[model samples]
Target: MLWWVLGGAALLVVAVVVTGVVLFVVAAGKSDRVWGVDDVAVGECVTVSGEDEPVVRKVSCDSTDFHFAVALKADPGVCAAKNYSRLWFGEGDSSDSFGKWARDGLCLAHVYQQGRCYHLPSSKETNALADVREIDCSSPPATGAGENYEVESKVSGMPECSEEQAEYFTEKPTPTGYCLRLLE
Candidate 1:
């Protein structure tokens, strides 16, 4: 009876250990999920001006720790005034479309500082209390405006960007310019 009890206890311990190992492996796989952009969908964008959800994409580059996110959002005040411009979301291989918008709108306010991105208020003097980057996509041509976008690390998934700001994601556009963080 004593030997049987010991064996049962040992088996319990082994089961617990295996469970822990599996959990750790799963978490490790998701660690990279925090580092990419999502595709864009109409639901994510505001209908009035065709503004998509605000996005916050992290810039990955030459071993330099750039802890910042990009945002794109719309100001209803801007749209109410017949501003045909729209906000767009950019991910890996989807950055250029925002630049070629036929609406001739400015989606993102290029920031050089180190911090979170956010939306500009109706006043144009203050940003909304949200930390994100806003892009415009109101016109149909604006949808395909981006041509310089590209996807880099398949292992790392799409470029690591904050999804809290975005409402859509797309693999169609490739990222370009300085946004595509290339490892040297």
Candidate 2:
């Protein structure tokens, strides 16, 4: 009788340990799961790369590599607003089968943090947010090398910037905008 009780207790302990391990493994897998453009929702963060053919990957909001947030997931040309970058799928590639995964591409908005300085296009010929790169505020670029702007505030919708000389960078769907003042 004593042996049977001891054996039963051992089995219960083993079962509990196995169950815990399985749960942990499942949770970890879910957390590490990579998401495609269609798999992501609005408000989630993502990193965008490539020039001709852009490669976008969904990432954690806190990730350092995160460049934009999914403002909206809609058809092509739906993100026709200033400062909102559109990533259209099924363009260039003529594969008919690829059309299935072509719908609901991403409309990404630049993730700008207040107080941070970034190098933006100064000329009217180029997109304002093109070639955006973070730069040290203490030491700005020389006069002909791109414009340096410091993000003053982030606001929703099209509210007028408090700073008189602040430039606006607005996104559609989400309608989040950033007020950037030229760093002189």
Candidate 3:
């Protein structure tokens, strides 16, 4: 009888612990200021380098909010043929002639808006200022430039804003790339 009682107590404890963990995760997602479709601007343009030429595309938002949505184009019949079926936000092939990988991640594309460099999650965003807008890239990619792609998975966490915007937004709080939320 005592053995059965102990087993029940152990199970109860385990259940409570698991429940607590799940609750914490849900709370964290909510507290992270999880972004939504309303947080992004429609028809944002970004530049991507394909095998032959550089392609420009637009960004899209998801219903979940706080996700990355970018499409790319690659030259046909190239080693890095642009395909829309995989994750879109990542570093591309830009290695030194000597054979060293240049950037930590793929320089997927150049985001529009001067003085602001946007980075998707799975890339470096630590040095980026707090004012940098962090978008969620978990949504499917939006179509652009006659391609069907989606920005689904990301390797890193938090996208970064341009350095110039980091400064101006931090200093003047104008409608600069540096600023995220509007200043009162």
Candidate 4:
């Protein structure tokens, strides 16, 4: 009924360097900056991960200009961005996984560059920096055309039935493995 829208490694003895990035970039500035999950620090914000080459458009963390702080990060051998989706959808597969609901609530609109688009964070931007650019989540976007949607708070992973505590608490998955929803 409300709004609309929405790691790393250290090679010791002999390091191996690989170069071939697949990225899907989005920026609030005239030019977007490249960054990855690893580049993101704990408590910092970042674009949600998905199949689309990881997008790492940096935003100022000091300000309320972004969503989803860098709750977790992974390296090449550990897992792929798709794993981010797995971790997200499967309610996270392990003890050390990141909590999907662990995020700032002042701005709860899950605006995926105006809509939830990307699913798995890509490998390309996995090595990029993500602590610089500033995109204000509170301010009206520059385009001012995209829509925003409602976000349910108590809704846990794929709830089968609605509860009195959370009548609108619903959970669904996108093909790529994320979600876009609104009872608004």
Which is the better candidate, 2 or 4, if ranked by TM-score?
Answer: 2
Q: Pick the candidate with the highest TM-score.
A: 2
Better of 1 and 4 by TM-score: 4
All candidates: TM-score = 0.26, 0.58, 0.22, 0.27
| Candidate 1 vs candidate 3, lDDT winner | 1
Error of 2 at 49 (Å): 7.8
Using lDDT, give the best candidate's number: 2
Which scores higher on TM-score, 1 or 3?
1
Poorly placed runs, candidate 4 (over 4 Å): 1-34, 48-52, 62-66, 75-149, 152-181
The residue-by-residue lDDT of candidate 2 on 159-179, one tens digit each, is: 467745565655554676777
Displacement of residue 40 (Cα, Å) in model 4 is: 1.8
Per-candidate Cα lDDT values, in order, are: 0.30, 0.64, 0.29, 0.29
TM-score of 2: 0.58
lDDT of 1 by residue, 127-147 (tens): 221222332222112212122
Candidate closer to the true structure by lDDT (higher is better), 1 or 4: 1
Question: Which regions in candidate 2 have their CA more than 4 angstroms from the true location?
Answer: 32-34, 47-67, 80-82, 88-104, 119-133, 140-147, 159-166, 171-173, 182-184
Estimate the overall C-alpha local distance difference test score of candidate 3: 0.29
Q: Which pairs clash (backbone N, Cα, C closer than 3 Å) in model 2?
A: none
